[model samples]
Target: MTTTTISEVKSINTPSVIQINADIPLDQALEELIRNSKEISITRGKRKGKFETGADKEGLELLPESSKERLQADGIDIQAGYPEAPPREDIPIYLDQAFEIRNYDVPFVDRGKNADPEKKSLFGAATEIINLTKNVGTEIVGLQLEDLTDQQKDELALLIAERVVVFFRDQKLSPSAQHKLGDYYGNVEVHAQVAHVPGLPGTTVIWNDYQVKKGMNLNFATSNLSNWDSTKYLNVGNQGWHTDLVHERQPAGYTHLHLDAIPDVGGDTIWSSGYGAYDKLSDEFKKFLDGKEAVYVSAHQYLDREDPFGGPKRIERVHPLVRTHPATGWKFLYVNRGMTKRIVGLSPVESDLVLNYLFDVYEKNADIQVRFKWTNSKQGYGTSAIWDNRISQHRNVWDHEGDQPRHGTRVTSLAEKPYFDPESKSQREALGKYLHQWD
Candidate 1:
């Protein structure tokens, strides 16, 4: 029988090599057991007594009763913990493409055709549209997300692209159901870096008190906490407003956040419209920024092992400054105050001036924004907000003081990379409406 060493596995870049260094002691114990093993005749066949169990006694005790029974039936020592390593010949190693990180290709089908705003037409079933703002957010008052027809889901996608952010109250959407809904939109982003629901791949647990309750830290790559120092309080102005997953090769499209637990008051979320922000700029300014690109950096820093100083480096991506929504064929500003660092092909000072102005247009403007309260008056509990990440920036307000819990589950679907279409018109331009621009 051929025996493969740990070095051999490491040479091939086997993903399980991460465990080898830590499991050296177990390997040593297995070697000792094998050296001292005594052959015994069992019901199945002749085998080494207790030598087959590679685990320690404590490890075996920690295993489930069902697992122990199965091990006992297999003639393995249940009391002694670790299971014997199968022969190297039995373990086949094949290259898996799933281990490689690649750009997500979203199946983009424009569903705006199904969104007929006629007398009998709405997004399937009975519904009342509550416009939170003149431009950005809307609330679809009737249907449950769990029970949506394919046609209805298409229309809903269209509505979210148009409205930017949509809110639903008193809805029962489980983690599994949420994942399915996200998949319908696009490829649900399952981030290995974030804290997610147990057994649920794409559902990120957004519990504010998770660290305190679970004695574990929940660090999302989109969070800006790692970028700041002791001067954080003074430096954190308007930096919280950001589009989700901007550093990704294929950025976020639709982000659905379902808040199950919310305080009696406060912890409201505010979403700003990219469409409105773009319209706020002058025609000349829009023309200038139409094909420009910007650099976006991820919030978390990774150690640069190759560097002599061993300093941390953030993941960076370059995307168009102005991006067109595929569903609407409308151009919108894509830079965020949080992750967006600089504009390409411009000097440092020029880039800073331009980016700061663009940030202000989105964050400072109140008319193009929607602030939604999670605690419904009737439901008094669950509320959901599904926003189009392509044309919006959102911030979670932590105004709720004391130990009041604010918890939620979020599922984000990755869409196509940011692209600017010169043929795409602004919302106002497409609608033939006049927009007052900044002087």
Candidate 2:
């Protein structure tokens, strides 16, 4: 108490400090010494590359006193900072740069909405029939295929998308003209294997009668009815719940059929909405088919040989039991009569039971069905029907055999694959509302 040692006072330059070696200029080294309070055990010749610390004599320089002091003050912090963090190598210079942000949530709005009024009104007038059926199906009147304007063509496209199917009564269009009208929808491809009018290049005929031998260009009959189990000839028959030839890797997207010389009393064509078919199923059935897939094969009804139609014996594919429509984004049952074979992860017996039940449901629901009776109308000449194969099914009645010879030509389009949308609940609701009307 009587005497206090000067050593007790903190030294501005303490002897307890460890020596530091720095490969720097004398002036710069001196600055570091003052800044870190590090003692220089060895100094340079006051020039570059001449300095070396005592620790460097053997290996690396010892810790400076200032560093030790910092460590003692914050032991954890020092340890954390020095823990094996290597210098960043090959880092991208723009890693932290800002970018132009974009909003993807907003849907693209139709620019035609704000187009010039005069131009819009002109197109509107011609597309009136198409506009009227935007929410439901309608019969087109006072419009001929040959007389359609560009506006009318645009209107027809919109109508087909909304109504799913459109009927032209008593059309005076020849096979070629009808084919041209279908071209407006998209490119038309002749059916792979069907009767074609003689010398009519690009025309595929749909005549079912074997009696007519005049101007015989192409005469082909499906074996579906002839050989019940044979699916080859029936390859194109009763393609239930399917668009068209989905068994192919690329299926036809659109099909147009003209009812020329229809029987007087019978042979009406029936169409069922596959989208509606899915809506009518019980929740349990829907859930069961949600993730399941099936295999579809084509066979013949009449031919006994393996190569019934000189095509591949079986066309097998794996498609979801519930497929979504591409444009409308709505889900639908994908099973059909022509090709669907077996369900994945189910026994043969179980698959058959499930498929049969689904078939029964589609067959029984009259509300989801529309039967068009062809009657003589002043509208035009041939009774033509155009439908999107992506979401609808059609069948012909054999009852009109003896009345009037029924035959026509069809043009198919290879359009985009069908897809489903989760947001198409509104479309389903609208379809449900019209269920009773179909019945």
Candidate 3:
């Protein structure tokens, strides 16, 4: 029998303690105790000190009675208590100390389901398809994402496969609608970590004031870290370019972000093309990396089973460095400067040199990227961007500087595992649009 003390909850005056012997993990034991035990001796105490002004407080304040009623009508569990706004004051920032297991084993679905681009008109209601840049981004001018038909959704999936990212403006898209759109693409990823919208399982909350609300002693916004790599270059700990959730077995496929609130100035987002990045490399270098694999680390840290007392370590997953897009059969550079670590068989120094150069090729190229500023919409509604995460990397520009608020909700769908097909061709090659200058 292992004797342990509950350090997470400590008594202010006199300790109220409970100890039991069980053949299970401490965290599992605690969870079982909370669920089964009738008489818990733990006393709830009012948290001392100031609270950070964040989304939770703002969202709770802005939550309408109709929304709550709708949630209840839809059979949402209301027992999960909401956080109350605390007095605005500074507090020390601490890391997540709770021991929780995060595992995802659901089989991935093919994102390009029943794609029929040849069908009469793909956009259905959309009047125009605006290519934002030469390579990566496109904007569907006339349709609301919420109103897309099954065929249109399939066409949109194919379009995103080709364009990498597409945008829609002046849209009245709700969290539920956005989630449905995500479901059409693949299995919507339910994240264990991060703050989610109330009653919405997979919808992640993207608030500018997250760090402050979470008691982090930081002056800048949480989005600031997205672009930190741009200033630091190849330095360690700088997250420059990144595809979301690359650590998952079946990595993130389609990621939809709808920003309901935008700042007057700053807070733009930029995305770069993986297809173009792959094309930028020489045939010799491409051949060298075609079948190679690299390890990707998770954004959140987890405990190492070998040393439970030791600090948590980031979860890692290995994927092909050059992956073939399932829909387009186009080879794209699958590695990102953020999550991707060293190559599988290469020495640490060799991997570093190769990865740094590959990252530079993707990040330094301007022609293969698109930078979009979220501004006025047609109906003064929110703007949305749906991107194929398998072939693109994006970074949020933190130029807003905390003067204004930017909040959004994001839903991501997990698709098939990263794979490389030897028979796959690069985008330009497949389109018979070879670069004469390079030749």
Candidate 4:
């Protein structure tokens, strides 16, 4: 049996992360665990445990004593809180990539609300990030999704959480890599109501043409136009800004939409920052919206077509109009024009007025948004737009009216339900740059 030692650990670049190989001999496992735990204790200054008061909760947390109850041993090896993988339930989202996804570390300070924050600069990661807008969008280059180390992935999550949307050019990311990238940040979410790539389980196919499926059909049938079409297919949805899968309570966290097939002209997409919308609201308006909730319903789901992608019935959910970002503790206006049905606790007319005003805030504001004209280089490189749906809204521009069509796959990650915390700061306050730019 091969044994890993401290010298071997030091030889690798992982100063803080612990790499645990699966199915190792019990003796070797214990030795490495104990040795690594000791090494962690000595190196506590740079990286602190989850329970400890530290700069950032980016450090690994100790395995809980309670987890010991769930440990299983099979004569030669020990597995902690492990479940048997069913044969039929197996499909590799990321092919050729290998690594067990480690459990998420406890954040440094629960968004720095209760603990002292470690000093962090604008671009916290070592990746190349070019800001596309003052508040909303950023283009991240010099890195591929497949090549990200665990720590770098964590940092990228933090960056996108703050920036709202990060764009990539020429990233020929496969559906597997796209899904895996979403998994690194959170759970790869399968669309309950939309069609997906044939073999790729969670990767959604946003085919903007004839082959598109049942869900989101009304939007396609309407051709993203303002007026009613000849067929009169309900005539409203998705031409405006929207967050994907917001019809559910626990909305999608991160969305990696890869536009592999881009039209040469008129297929540009726009992203607006929810943080900017919230911050620009009047103090009285903000206070009025603080505890209020809104009900969101998907128009396409209720369309009079047979359900194409079969799943559970999509249910309308009530969520806070103003939501707090769990990672950064920043506040954003969460209401979107696409799916938002009504504001609860208000009269129908009052709800209409309020919702219309909120929609106006997102639509009229160009200061907090970035528009990207999608394209590929002369060589075969492509662009993908990744966004934090919780604090952002995106609209796909379909001005391209030729035989060439727009097509892409989108992967959405699951996150906690939309919520509002009175203590949460605005996006402007959290970043410490672009102050009052939106207002």
lDDT of each: 0.66, 0.49, 0.69, 0.59
Please list all clashing residue pairs in model 1, or write none if there are none.
55-82
What TM-score fits each model?
0.71, 0.57, 0.79, 0.65
In candidate 4, which residue pairs clash? 56-108, 57-107, 57-108, 170-382
Compare the candidates by lDDT and give the number of the best one. Answer: 3
Better of 1 and 4 by lDDT: 1
TM-score, candidate 1, is 0.71
Candidate 3 structure quality by residue, lDDT tens digits, 214-313: 3333334333443445323321111246788888778899899988777789878889899999999888898899999999876655445445457546
- Which of candidates 1 and 4 is the stronger one according to TM-score? 1
Residue ranges of candidate 3 with Cα displaced over 4 Å = 1-59, 62-114, 216-239, 378-380, 436-439
Lowest-lDDT window of 10 residues in candidate 1?
40-49
1 or 3, greater by TM-score: 3
Residue-level lDDT tens digits of model 2 in 29-148: 333443243232112111111222111221112222322232233222232221111112211111011011110122222122233423443344443443222333445655566676
Candidate with top TM-score is 3
Model 1 per-residue lDDT tens digits across residues 1-439: 1222222123555552322233344434333332333331110111111222123344333333433332344344334333222222221111111123444455655444355534133443756878888888989888788887776777788889888998888776666787889988888887634445544557765655432232222223323442232114211212267788888888889889987667788778899999999999998899899999999876444433234135435567799999999888899999876688899999999998898888889888999999998865554336789999989998876566324766667899888777889999999999898977657
The TM-score obtained by model 3 is 0.79
Worst 10 residues of 3 by lDDT: 40-49
